[model samples]
Target: MIDRFLDRLAALVEPTILALVIILLAWIVLRLTRATIQRAVARALQSERLSAREEAARVRTLTTLAESAVRLTVILLALLTILSIYGVPIGPLLASAGVVGLALGLGAQTLIRDVIAGIFIVLEDQYHVGDVIHVNNVSGSVEALTLRYTALRTLEGAYVIVPNGEIRIVQNLSRDWARAIIDVPLVPEEDVDRIIDILRPLLAALPSDPELGPLVLEPGEVFGVESIGQQQATIRIAVKTRPREQWRVARELRRRILYALREAGISAPYPRTVMIFHPSSPQPPASS
Candidate 1:
C-alpha cells in the first residue's frame, strides 16, 4: 500500500516539477531577449535628439511589443514541451492553432487596427503625454497613451478612453509657440499713430522684461486695425509665447493695456443712442 502511494505521488509530482523547470528556463531566455530588444530600440530612438517625453513614449511602445512577442513565444514553447512529455501529436495542434488564430484575428480586426495605428502614432510623435489635443471632438490633455488606446483627462476632469483607429484627425495645440491675440477698441477720435507709438515702445521693451523673458517668445506687435466702427476702431495686437502660454499672456496684456490707457487719459468709446418720436407724440397739449 505504501509503495502504491509513493508511486502515485511520483506520477503527479515529477511532471509538475519538470513543467515548472521548463517554464522558468523559458522565462529567463525570454527576459534576456526582451532586454536586448529594448536596448537596441532605445539606442535607435536616442539618435534623434528626442525629448524625455518622446523617449518615454518610445520605450513604452517597444516594451509593450517585446512583452507581447515574448509571451506568445513562451506560451507556444510551454505547450509544445508539455505535449511532448505526454506523447501527444503536435502536427494537428499547429494546424488547429492556425485556423483558430485566423478566426480570432478576423473577429478582432478593429482592435488590431487600433494597436497598429497607436504604434505608428507613438513612433511618429503625433502627440505625447501632457499634450493638449483635439481628437474627434473630444478635446483634452493626454493623460496616458498606449498601443491599445489613449486616455485623456477632459477639461472638466472626466477621463476618456479613445481608440486609436477612431482618431481621424489630431490637433496638437501645445507644440512650439502660440499666438496671444487681443483686440482693443479705442474712440475713433483718438490718434491711431499715438496709440501705435505708445504700444510700440512697450512691446519692444517686452522681450527684455524679466517677468516675461521666459514666457514671451516674441514681442507683441500691432497686427492691424480690424475695423473702424461708428464710435471706435478695433486695434489688433498679436504676441507669440511658448505653447500653452498664450492665454496667460493675453490676460496680462489686457490688464496692462487698460492701465496704460487710463494713465494716458484715453476714454474708450461707448455706444451712441438715437431717439425717434411718433407722429402722434410730436404735438404736445398746451398747459394752463
Candidate 2:
C-alpha cells in the first residue's frame, strides 16, 4: 500500500509543476503582448496628423482589442498545454471544439456580426469615445465601446446600448470643426440693411472675446435676408468654431444678440391675427 501511494504521488508531481509553469508563461506572454500592441498602435497613428487626445484614444482602442484577442489565445493555448501534460488527448478535444465552435457560430450569428462590425469600426476609426455621433437616428456621445456593443450617453442623461451590427450611416458631429448657424427673425417692417449693420460689428467682435476667442476659428459672417415671410424676415449668421464648441458659441451668441437687439429697441417678430366678423342681421331677426 505504501509503495503504490508513493508511485501515484510521484506521477502527479511532474504534471502539477508543468501546469504551474505553463500558467506563469501565459501570464508573461499576455503582459508582453499588451505592451507590444500598445506600442505598435501608438507608432502606427503617429503619422496621421491627429491631435494628441485623438491619437491617444485611437491607440487605446486598438490596443484594448488586440490585447483581448491575445489574452484569449494565450489562455486557450495554456489550458490545452496543461491538459496534454496530464495525458489528456488534445487531438480529440480540438476536434470537439471545432464542432462546438461551428454550432455556436450558426446559433450566434448576431454576435459574430456585431464583432465583425466592431472590428471594422475600430480599424476605420469611425468615431472615438468622446465623439458625439448620430447612429440609427439616435444621437449621443460615446461613453464606452466593446466588441459586441457601444454605450452612449444622450444629452438628456439617458444611457443607450447599441449593438455594433446595427450601426449604419454614422453621423459624426464632433470631428474636426463645426459651424454654428443662427437665424435671427425680425419683424418684416424692420430694415434689413440696418439689422445687418447692427449684427456685423457684434459678430466681428466675437473673436475678440476672451472667453470665446480660443474656440472661435473664424469671425462670424452675416448672410443678409435668408427668407422673407409675411410676419418676419430671417437674417442668418454663421460662425466657424472648434469641434464641440458650436453649440456653446451659438447659445452665447444668441443671448448676446438678443440683448443687443433689445438695447437697440428692435423687437422680435410675433404672430398677429386679424379677425373680421360679418353681421347676420336677417338670421338674428328670424331667431328673435
Top candidate when judged by lDDT against the true structure: 2
Assess the local accuracy of residue 210 in candidate 1 as a C-alpha lDDT between 0 and 100: 83
Model 2 regions lying over 4 Å from their true place: 227-230, 277-288
Which residue pairs collide in model 1, if any?
A: none
Task: Give Cα-based local distance difference scores for all models.
Answer: 0.83, 0.90
Question: Per-residue lDDT of 153-263 in model 1, one digit per residue for the tens?
Answer: 998999999999898899987776688889989988898888887777777777898877678988888877889988789889988888777778788888888888888
State candidate 2's TM-score.
0.88
Worst 10 residues of 2 by lDDT: 279-288
Alpha-carbon RMSD to native, per candidate: 4.4, 2.8
List the candidates' TM-scores in order. 0.74, 0.88
